[model samples]
Target chain A: MFRYILRRILYMAVTLFIIATVSFFLMKMLPGSPLKAEDKLSEEQREIVLEKYGLNDPVPVQYVRYIGGLVKGDLGISFTFDNTPVTKILMDRIGPSAQLGAQALLIGTFLGILLGLIAAISHNGALDYTSTILAVLGTSIPSFVFAGLLQRYLAVEWELFPVALWGTFEHTILPTVALMIFPMATAARFTRTEMIEVMGSNFITTARAKGVSEYGIIFKHGLRNALIPLVTVMGPMAVSLMTGTLVIEKIFAVPGIGEQFVTSVMVNDYPTIMGTTLLFAFLFVLIILVIDLLYVLIDPRIRLTGGES
Target chain B: MSKLLEVKDLKVSFNTYNGEVQAVRGVTFDLNKGETLAIVGESGSGKSVTSMALMQLLPKPHGYVKSGEILFEGEDIVKKSTRDMQKIRGKDISMVFQDPMSSLNPTMKIGNQIMEGLIKHQNMNRTNARKKAVELLELVGIPHPETRLNQYPHQFSGGMRQRVVVAIALACNPKILIADEPTTALDVTIQAQILELMKDIQKETDSAIIFITHDLGVVANVADRVAVMYAGKIVEIGTTDDIFYNAKHPYTWGLLGSMPTLDSDEEELFAIPGSPPDLLNPPKGDAFAPRNEFALEIDTVMEPPMFKVSDTHYAATWLLHEDAPKIEPPESVQRRMQGFSNTGSKDGEK
Candidate 1:
C-alpha cells in the first residue's frame, strides 16, 4: 500500500509538470498581454513595460525561469491585481471556494445516495419515478439557469435568502445549492444504476435465501457493493464541483478563486492563470488518490496492487 | 417418519415480458425429517424454483408461487405473510445457494455472515453469536475456525467459502436445509468433500435436506429419495433404490443412462435425446413426450397422472398403465441397472 501511494504521488508530480508546461505555453500563445490596450506609446515605452515583467525573454527561457520560480514556492506577481503575489492572491480566495465545494459535496453526496437508495429499493414505485425525473432534470438544466431560477423564486420573490454576495450562512445557501444539483444528480444516477444492478446480483439472492430481511439484504449485501462504483465517480465529481463553481461564484458575487480564475484569463494574467490551473490539477490528482485509497477500505477484495489478490 | 415439509400442487410462475412463464406446474412432494430428498433435473426445470418457493425467496415482481400449499409443521406457508415468512426463514428453514463465491457477501467476514441469521432469527446477542459462529465454522469442517472468523469471503478458497455458506445455513439449526446445487461451482474433489460434510452435519443435526442438483452421480451418494423433474413437473419420484435399480419413467431412465457408472465400459456416453420443453406456452399434454423414445399415442394428447408403482414409488407416465403396450427400458438403461448391483458387489468385495 505504501509503495502504491508513493508511485501515485510520483505520477502526480509528473502530471502537474506537464499541465504547468502546457498552460504556460497556451497563455503565452494568446493574442493579448497584461499591458493596457488604450494609449499608444513609444517603442521604448513598450520595451520598458516588457522588460519590467521579463516578457522580453525567449519563450523557452521564460519557461525555465517559471519552473525555477515554482521551485522556490513563488508564483510570481499578478499583473492585473496591483502587483500582488499570485500565491497570496490565491490564498485569499482559496478558503471560500474550498468551503463552498466541501459544503456542496457533503450535502450533495449524502442526499444523492439516500435518494438513490430509496429509488432502487422501491424500484418502479412512484418514489422511484419521481427521483428518476428529478435526477434527469438536475443533470439536464445548467446550474446558472437553475441558479437564476432559485434566486428569482427563492431569493428575490420569497426572500428566503439574501439576493447576492457572500457573507453569513444564509448567503452561502443558494449558491451552494446551485453548485450541488449537478453533482447530486450524477451521484444519484450512478448510485441508482449501481444499486439496482447490485441488488439483483446473485449475492443478494443468496442473502434473501439466508432469510435476511429486505432491509438487511438491501443495506448489507446490496449497498456496500453498489458504493464501489459510486466512489469511482466521486473523483471526477469533486474536480467538477471545484472548477464548475466559477460561474456560480460570479453570479452569487462570492469572492472565490473561481471568479478570479475567469478575470485572470480575460486579461491574460499569466501568473494567476498558471497558479489556478496548477491548483485545479493538483486538487484533481489528490482527489483521485484519496478515491483509490477508499476503494481498498471499502472492498477487501480490491488489493492495493490494483487487482484482486 | 414424521413429515417435515409437504408441498401439494405447488405451482410457480415468472411474469416475463412475453407472458407468464409457468416455471413449476403443480409439483407435489413431501420431505421426511432427517432425510435428504434430491430434486434432480436440467436447467429451467423448476428444481431451484421449487426450493425457493418453499422458503418464499422467489424474486419479487416477477417470480411467485401461482398455486401451492407448503405445509411445514401443520401450517400452510403460502398463507403466511411476508413478515411471518421472515420469522420462518433462517429460523425454521435456511438455504445454501449455488456459486459459493457469490453466495457469501464478499465485503463481510465469514463469521458475521453466519452469525447474522443467528442474531436475527435466534435472537442471540453479539457475543454469543460470535462464539456460536466459531462453533458453526468448526461444524462445517473449516480448519482454524478462530483465525477464520474475521477473514472476508475473498480470503477463502472456493471449497472453504462453500463450507462457510453451509455453516451460515446451519447456524440456527434450521428445520429444513435447502441446498440448491451448493457444490455445482466447486471442483470434483471439493464437490465430494462438501457432500460428505453436508451428510455428516445432517446426521448430527437431523435436519431434513432438500438437495437440488442436476447430477445423478451426486444424487446416488447424498439423496435418500430422488425426484426426476421434467419441464416444471416431477415426472417420477421414488426411494433411491427404486429410482436407481427399478426406475419406472423414461425420463428417469434417460437420466440414469446419461450418468457414467464405474462398471460400465461403454465407449460412447449416452446423452439424453432432446432438451426440456419451454415453460412459456408449455406443451398441451406431457411435456416430455417429444423427448421420450417410447412415448405412447396418448402421451402427446393427455398428461399422465402419477401412478403408484409400489408403496413408495410413483411415476407420471402412460407407460405405467396396464393397458399401455409394455416397453422395456433401453439397453443402456438395463446395463446401468445391472451395473449398480455389479458396483455394489465390487464395493462389498473391497
Candidate 2:
C-alpha cells in the first residue's frame, strides 16, 4: 500500500509538470501581450515594461527560467496585476470559492443521497419520478441558468436572500445553490442506479430474510454498497467543483480564484494562468489518488498490495 | 410430530409487462417440527416462489402471493403486514438462499451478518451477539470461528461462505430454516459436506427445514419427505422411503431417472423430454403432459387430482386412478429405484 501511494504521488508530480509545460506554451500562443492591456501606456513605457519582465528572451530560455523559479517554490510575478506574486494573489482569492464550493458539495451530496435513497426504495412511485425529473433539470440546465433563476426568484422577487455579489452568508446562498446543481444531479443519478442494483442483489434478499428492518436494509446493506460507486463519480466531480467555479463567480461577482484565472488569461497574465492551471492539475491527480485509496478503505476486497505499482 | 408450518392452496404470481404469470399455482404442503422436507422441481416449477412466499420476500409490484394461507404455528402468515413479517422473519423463520457467493453482503464481516439476527430478534447486546456469532460459525463447522468471525465473506471459500450463510440463518435459533437450493451452487463434494453439516445441526437444534432443490440425490440424503413440484404444483409427495422406492408420478420417474447412481451403468443421462410449460399461458390440463412419455389421454383434457397411494403417500397422476391404463416406470428409472430400500435411511423417518 505504501509503495502504491508512493507511485501515485510520483505520477501526480509528473502530471502537474506536464500541465505546467503545456499551459506555458499555450499562454505564449496568445496574440496580445500583457502590455497591450494597458492602452494608456506610451510606446517607450511599454518597451521598458516588456524588457523589465524579460519579454525579449527566447521561449526556451523563458521556459528554463520558469522551471528554475518553480524549483524555488516561486510562481513568478503576474504581468497584469501590478506584478504581484501569482501564488499570493491566488491565496487571497481562494477563501470565497472554497466556502461556496464546500457548502454546495456537502449539502448537495447529502440531499442527493437522501433523494436517491427515497427514489430507490419507493421505486416507480411519485417520489421517484419527482427526483428523476429534478436530476434531469439539474443536469441539463447549467449552473449560470440556475444562478439566473435563483437571483430572480429569491433575491429580486421574493426577497428571500441577496440577489448577487459576495458579502455575508446570505449573499453566498444563491451562488452556492447554483453551483450545487451539477454535483447534486451526478450524485443522485449514480446513487439511484447503484442503490437500485444493490437493493435487488442476493445479499439484500438475505438481509431481508434475516428480518432486517426496511430502514436497516436500505441504509446498511443497500446504501453501503451504493456508496462505493457514488464516491468513484464524486471524487473527480469534487476536484472540478473545487477548482472551477468561474462562470458562477462571474454571475455572483465573487472574488474567487476562478474569476482571477479568467481575468488573468484574458489580459495575458502568464504567471497566474500557469499557476492556476498547475493548481487545477495537482488537485485532479491528487483527488484521483484519494479516490483509489478510499476504495481500499470502503471495500474489504480491494487490498492495495505493494506489488500493485 | 406437530405441524410447524401449513401452506394451503398457496398461489404466487408475477405481473410482468406481458401479463400476470401464475408462477406457483395452488400449492399445498405441511412442514413438521424437526423434519426436513425437500421440494424438488425443474426451473420455473414454482418451488422457489413457494419458498419465497413463506418469507414474503417475493419481488413487490411484480411478484406477490396471489392467494394462500401460510399458517405458521396456527397464525396465517399471509395476513401479516410487512412490519409484522419482519418480526417473524430471521427470528421464527430464517432462510439460506442458493449461491453463497452472492447471498452474503460482500462489504460486511461474516460475523456481523450472523450476529444481526441475534441482535435484532433476541435483543442481545453486542458482546453477547458477538459471542453467539462465533458459536454459530463453529456450529456450522467453520474452522477457527473466533478468527473467521472478523473476516468478510469474500475472504472465505465458496463452501465456507455457505457455512457462514447457514450460521446467519441459525443465529436466532429459528423454528423453521428455509434452505432454497442451499447446495445447488456448491461443488459435489462440498454439497455432501454441507448436507452432512445440516443433518448434524438438525440433530443439535431440531429446527424444521424446508429444503428446496432440483437435485433428487440431495433430497434422498437430507429429506424426511419428498415433494415433487411440477408447473407450480405438487405432483407427488410421500415419505422418503415411499417416493424413492414406490414413486408413482411420471414426473417423479423422470426426476429419479436423471440421477446417476454409482453402480448404474447407464450410457446416457436421462433428461426430461421437454422444457417446463410457460406459466403465462399454462396448459389447461396436466402441465407435465407434454414432457411425460406416459402422459394419458385424459392428462391432455383435465388436471389429475391427488390420488392417495397409501396412508403416508400421494401422487397427482392419472396412472394412480383406476381408469388409467397400467404402466411401469422406464427401465433406467426402475434400475435406480431397485437399490433404494437398503440405502435410503436419511434420518427423516415419519
Candidate 3:
C-alpha cells in the first residue's frame, strides 16, 4: 500500500509537470502577445518589460526559469491588473469560489443520492418516473439557463430571495442551485441505475433469504455496493463543479476565483493564468489520489498490493 | 417422524411479455423431520421455482405463487405477510443457493455475514454472535475459525466460500433448510465433500432439507425420499429404496438409465429424449407424453392421477393403471437398481 501511494504521487508530479509545460507553450502560441497595448508603450519601455520577465530569452530558457520560479513558490506577476503577484490574487478569490462550490456539492450529492434511493426502491412507480424526468430536465438545461430562470422567478417575481451577488444564505441559493443541477442530475442517474442493478443482484437475494430487514438489505447491501461506481466519478465531478463556476459566477456577479481566472484570461494576464491552471491541475491530481485511497476503505475486495489497487 | 413442511396444490406462474408462463403446476409434496427430500428434474421443470416458492422469495411483478398453501408445522405460510415472512425466513427456514461465489455479499466479512442471522433472528449480542459464528464456521468444517472470520469472501476458495455460505444458512438452526443445488458449481471431489458435510450437519441440526438438483447421482447419496418433477409436476415420489429398487415411472426409469455406472459398457450414454415442454403453452394433457416411450393413448388425452405402487411409493403414469398392459422397467434400469442394492448390501455387511 505504501508503494502504491508513493507511485501514484510520482505519477501525479509527472502529470502536473506535463500540464504546466503544455499550457505554457499553448499560451505562448496564441495569436497576440501578452503586451496587448505595446503601441501605447515607448520602445525602451517595451524592451524593459520584456527583459524583466525573461520574454526576450529563448523558449527553452524561459521554460527553465518558469520551473525555477515554481520550485521557489514564486508565480511571477500578472501582466494586467497593475502587475499584481498572481499568488495573492488567487488566495484572495479562492475563498468565495470554494464556499459556493462546496455548498452546491454537498446539497447536490445528498439530494441526488436520496432521490436515487427512493426511485430505485420504488422502482417503476410514480416516484421513479418523476425522478427520471427530473434528472433528464436537470441534465438537458444548462446551469446558466437555470440560473436565469431562478433569478427571474424566485427572486424577481416570487421575491423569495435576492436576485444576484453573494453574502447571506438567501443570496447563495439561486446560483448554488443552478451550479448544482448538472452534478445532481449526473449523480441521480448514476445512483439510480447502479442501485437498481445492485438491488437485483444475487447477493441481495441471499441477504433477504437471511432475513435481513428491508432497510438493512437496501442500505447495507444495496446502497453500499452501488456507491463504488459513484465514488469513482465523484472526484472529477467535484473538481469540475469548482472550475465550472466561471459563467455562473459572472452571471451572479460573485467575486470568485473562477471570475478572476476568466478576467485574467481575457486580459492576457500570463502569470495569473498559468498559476490558476497549475492550481486546477494540482487539485485534480490531489482529488484523484484521495479517491484512490478511499477505494480501499469502501471495498474489502480491492487490495493495494505493490502498485495495483 | 412428524411432517415438518407440507406444500399442497402449489402453482407458480410468471407474467412475461409473451404470456403467463405456468412454471410450477399443482406441485404437491411433504418433508418429514430430519429427512432430506430431493426434487430432481431437467432445467425449466420448475424445481428451483418450487423451492423459492416454499420460502416466498419468488421475484415479484413477474413471478408469483398463483395458487398454493405452504404449510410449515401446520401453519399456512402462503397466508403470511411480507413482515411475517421476514421473521420466518432465516429463523424457521433458510436457503442455500446454487452459485456460492454470487450468493455471498462481496463487501461483507465472513464472520459478519454468518453473524447477521444470529443478531437479527436470535437477537444475540455482538460478542456472543461472534463466538457462535466461529463455532458455526467450525461446524461447517472451516479451519482457523477465529482468524478466518476477519477475511472477506474473495479471500476464500470456491469450496471454502460455499462452506461459509452453508455456515451462514445453518447459523440459526432453521427448522427447514432449502439447499438449491448447493454443490452444482463445485468440482467432483468438492461436491462429494460438500454432500458429506451437509449430511453430517443435518444429523446434528436435525433439520428437514429440500435438496433441489438435476443430478440423480447426487440425489442417491443425500436424499431420504425423492420426488421426480416433470414440467412442474411431481410425476413420481417414493422412499429412496422404492425409487431406486422398485421404480415405476418411465421418467424415473429414463433418469436412472441415463446415469453412468462402473459396470455399464454402452457405446453412448442413454439421454432422455426431447426437451421439456414450453410452459407458456403447456401441453393440454400429460406434459411428458411426447417424451415418454411408455406413454399410452390416454396419456395424450388426459393427465393421469397419482397411482399407488406401494404404501410409501406413488407414480403418475398410465402404465400403473389396472386397464393398461402389464409392463416391467427397462433392462438397463433394472441393472442400475441391482448395482445400487449390491453396493448397499456390501455397505450393510461392513
Q: Which is superior by DockQ, 1 or 3? A: 3
> Which 10 residues in a row give candidate 2 chain A its minimum summed lDDT?
A235-244
CA lDDT for candidate 2: 0.89
Candidate 1 lDDT over residue span A13-117, tens digit each? 999999999989988898877777736877889899889999999999999999999979999999887779999999999988998899999899989999898
lDDT of 2 by residue, B83-195 (tens): 99999999999999899999999999888888888999999999999999888887888889999888988899999999989988988888999999999999999999999
- Model 1 clash pairs are none
lDDT of 1 by residue, B1-350 (tens): 99988999999999999999999999999999999999999999999999989989888889998997999998999899988998888778988989988777889887888888888887899999999998998888889999999999989999999999889888889899999999999999999999989988988999999999999888888888989998999999998888989999999988888887665685467888878888889998889999888988898899999999998899999998999998899998888887786567223322
Off by over 4 Å in 1: A38-40, A306-309, B345-350
Model number with the top DockQ: 2
> Candidate 3's residue-wise lDDT over B205-284, tens digit each?
89989999999888888888999999999999998888988899999999999988767876357898999999999997
Q: Which stretches of candidate 3 lie over 4 Å from their true place?
A: A36-38, A307-309, B345-350
In model 2, state the lDDT of residue A303. Answer: 85
What is candidate 2's lDDT per residue for A99-165, written digit by digit as tens?
9888998888988898888888778999999999999998888788888889889888999998777
lDDT of prediction 1: 0.89
Q: List the residue pairs that clash in candidate 3.
A: none
Model 3 scores a TM of 0.97
RMSD (Cα, Å) of candidate 3?
Answer: 1.8
